[model samples]
Target: MSGRDLLQTQLERGIAALGTSLPGGAVARLLDYQELLHRWNSAYNLTAVRDPAEMVTRHLLDSLAIIPFVEGATLADLGTGPGLPGIPLSIAAPEREVTMVDSNGKKVRFLREAIRSLKLTHAHAVQSRVEGVEGSFDCITARAFASLADMLGWGGHLLARNGVWLAMKGRHPAEELDGVPPGFRVEGIHLLNVPGLDAERHLVVIRREG
Candidate 1:
């Protein structure tokens, strides 16, 4: 089978394995997103995962694994290198506002192009340090951005009072808890079962302490 077809097959199986359903045209859009990433990655070295099929599991599925926990209507993806969960989540939930922030110039350009090509009216990209981003969000996501404490130090102000911070980590971060800021606390730690991925994935759900 061709690359696109193979990616489609893997995407389908991965989504099902996550027990998630796609919105209308989500599969196509995601495939397009993956293809775009692949194309740019050739020259930009955007991601380490070079194969399209692996991108299905490592990128798309890994991003979607947190969809069930997404809350509210506004989201900010800090340090969104190539717009992982940000773009996919924006596509999946068309009504929500999704802003992707990255400090890198080339990645920001790629993100803007992807948003334009995808016609993601609800999504926008900002080229700035995570701490410098303006505005608040009902939900925030930081994927491999930094340790829980350090991320909050920089981007914590962007989370609305009642908002939740979903920090994607590769493993259970037991030691990282000690460094968590005084105002925020770990609400829950969810083990993410990304399809076709054997590595440990955890979503550290954090909230402001009352």
Candidate 2:
């Protein structure tokens, strides 16, 4: 099989493994985004992961794993270096308004191009630090961006009153639990089962304390 076919098969299997059904044409769009990412990474060094199959696992599947936890109509992916979860999630669920925020100009440029080329009407890219980003969102996602404390300290204000904060961590961040800042509490830490990914993946869910 050709490389693109292999990648498509891997992605389809991974989605099936996750037991999540994406809308028609979503998978194709996701692959298109991945291809764009691969092309840009060569010159811009956007991400550390380079292998196509690994990208399907670590980037695409890893991002889709959190689809079950994502809620609300608006989502802000802070520190979205290359729109990992945001872009994928936007493709899967075209109804949500996704804002991919990042400080890197090159990454943001790529994001814009992907949005236009993929016809992602609900997704947009913003070049700014997480703290500098304005407006509240129904859901906020931070993946490998910063420590729990620092991430919340800088961008906590962006979460709406009833919004949830989904912090994607590598492992169970037991030590950082205490440093989650006041007013917010850890609701749950879900173990993400990313297909073809053996490493530890945890999703720390936080919300305003009632």
Candidate 3:
């Protein structure tokens, strides 16, 4: 089956598992993103998940799982390689401004293309390290970016006073929280049941106490 066909099937499976209605526009945007990723992956080597079916589970559904927690907020996706949670989040919540940051120039290029293709007015891709980018955000998200402690060290400064950091992890990160930085405090740890993927998922929300 073609990539688009596979994506459609996977999206159906995801919709069933999520048990929530996906925005009509989201389906088209996700298909477009998969097509672009497939085209770019040949040259840019953006993501390891080349199969469209896997992209739906690993990228689309996995990102969508956090939508309920991401209401209307200015979000920054640190280390957004090929715009995993960032691009998908932008598609799901068009009103929310999303900035996708990545250190890899090629991946940023692909992200920008996807943004343009999707006509995402509220989304932009930045080619820079997390620390180099300025401006505080209401919600900051990262997927497979770094360890909890490392993310806190670099991305902690980019969050607004009452902002929240939603870090996506594969497993419970209780042990990694032992040496958290001084300014931030863990508000909650949510176990995310992502659709179409069997991997363990956790959303760690942190906020600055002072």
Candidate 4:
């Protein structure tokens, strides 16, 4: 099957799974997010997963699994390569503001285009290093962005008071968390079951306490 066809089938199945496993209304927005990603990915190298079915596992479902833990507040996706959790999360929660930041101009361009095409009024894209972007957010997300220490050094300032940092990791990140900077505490570690993908995923929630 063509990439588009495979993607559609996977989306249908994934959405069904989400509807059964998660809350309603989330699946439909995920579908819309997939469509937006596919359209922009054709022109920009936003994601390495060219096949739609792969995207369902790598992008859509993977992103949706984190929705339950995210507090309903403004979020900043640091080093938002290809808008992983940011784009999908924004689609799922249109009422919440999501700012996606990437150092690469091309990726930021694609993210901006996707937001405009989807008419995501709550989504914004910024092309700058995490440290350069000035603002506080209720939540800061990072997917394969960097080591925990690096993220804390650069993206820590962007987190609002009482905010949390959600970091997606593969395998147990015991070593990564061991060296976390001061003022941040590990709140919780959640094992995520990403549909259609056979991989160990963990969402580490870090909070700032001053």
Candidate 5:
């Protein structure tokens, strides 16, 4: 089979593994986004993961694993290189407004094109540092962008009261939990089961303490 076909198959398998009940066309759009990412990575170097099949497991599935933890109507993906979790989450939850923020020019351009090409009207790309972003979001996602403390330090103000901050990490970050900001508290740390991904993946759920 051709490479794209193989990728489609892999993505379908991964989605089934996640056991997510998504709207129709969600899987197709994710495959399309990955294709666009692979094409652009040839020159722009958007992500380090090069193999298409691996991208299915590492990027797409890894991103979708956090879908269950998301809450509320708006989400902001900080340091969203190549729009990893942001684009996928936006596709899955089209009703929610997803804003992908990044400081890199090329990555932002790629994200815009993907959003337009994939017809993701609810998702928008912004070019700025996390600290410079404006407005509050009900859910904010940071995918290994920085330490839990530093990420909350830079973009913590953007989270709406009672909102949840979903931080993706490679391992259980026991040490990183030591310095969570004053307003936010560690609500939960759930382990992720990403099909075909061997490395440890955990989602750190932080919410503003009442």
Candidate 6:
């Protein structure tokens, strides 16, 4: 099989392992996004996982694994370096409005190019500190961006009423739970089983309380 074929097979199998279905052309777009990231990564160093196949497992599948938890029409991916879950989620669910937020100029530039090239009509990129970003979102996602306390402290105000906050962490963050700051409560912590990835993954679900 060719390299492209391998990537396709890997992505397909990983999607199947997740037991979820994506819209038609989603797989193709995802591969295209991966290719774009790979090419840009050569000069920009977007991510450390350099292999395409590994990108399928680590970047693509890992992001898709939280699809079930992601709700609401508007989503803000804070500290979204290279648009991880934001880009993939937008490709998978074209209807959701996704905003990829990052402080780094290069990453935001790459995100804009990806949005344009991928034709992600509902996705937008903003180069600003997470706390500085404006607008309320139905859902917020931060992938290992910062500690729970710090993330919620800085960007908690951006979450709309009854909005869900999904924080992706490598391990079960028991210690950080206490640091979740006031006005926010831990709803649940879900373990993510990403295909072809043998590492620990946890999604901490939080919500604003009255």
Q: What is the lDDT of residue 185 in candidate 1?
A: 77
Q: Kindly provide the TM-score of model 2 when superposed on the true structure, using C-alpha atoms.
A: 0.98
The positional error of residue 108 in candidate 1, measured at the CA in angstroms, is 0.4
How well is each residue in 58-176 modelled by candidate 4, as lDDT tens digits? 88888878877788479999888878889888877888999999999988888887788777799999999888998889998999678899999988988887889999998879888
User: What is the per-residue lDDT of model 1 for residues 104-182, given as tens digits with 9 covering 90 to 100?
Assistant: 9999999999999999999999999987899989999999778888999999999998789999999899999999888
Global CA lDDT of candidate 6, please?
0.94
RMSD of 5: 0.9
RMSD to the hidden true structure, all candidates: 1.0, 0.9, 1.7, 2.7, 0.9, 0.7
For every model shown, what is its TM-score relative to the native structure?
Answer: 0.97, 0.98, 0.93, 0.88, 0.97, 0.98
**Pairs of colliding residues, candidate 1:** none
Candidate 4 stretches with Cα past 4 Å from truth are: 1-9, 15-29
| Native-to-model Cα distance after best TM-score fit, residue 74 in candidate 5, in Å | 0.6
Q: Score residue 85 of candidate 6 by CA lDDT.
A: 89
Poorest stretch of ten by lDDT in candidate 3: 15-24
Q: Candidate 2 residues 110-146, lDDT tens each?
A: 9999999999999999999887899989999999678
In candidate 4 the C-alpha lDDT for residue 69 amounts to 77
Clashing pairs in 6: none
* Candidate that scores best on lDDT: 6
RMSD (CA, Å), candidate 4 to true, equals 2.7
Q: Which stretches of candidate 1 lie over 4 Å from their true place?
A: none
Residue-level lDDT for 204 in candidate 2: 97
Query: Which 10 consecutive residues of model 6 have the lowest summed lDDT?
Result: 177-186
In every candidate, how many clashes are there?
0, 0, 0, 0, 0, 0
Q: Tell me, by TM-score, which candidate is best.
A: 6
lDDT of 5 by residue, 132-195 (tens): 9999999999998789989999999999999999999999999999989899999999999999
Per-residue lDDT tens digits of candidate 3, residues 1-210?
A: 975776788787786777756677788888888888888998888888988778888888888888777744799999989998999888888888999999998998888889998999999999999889999899999985788889989988998887888889999988989767888889888998887677899998888765
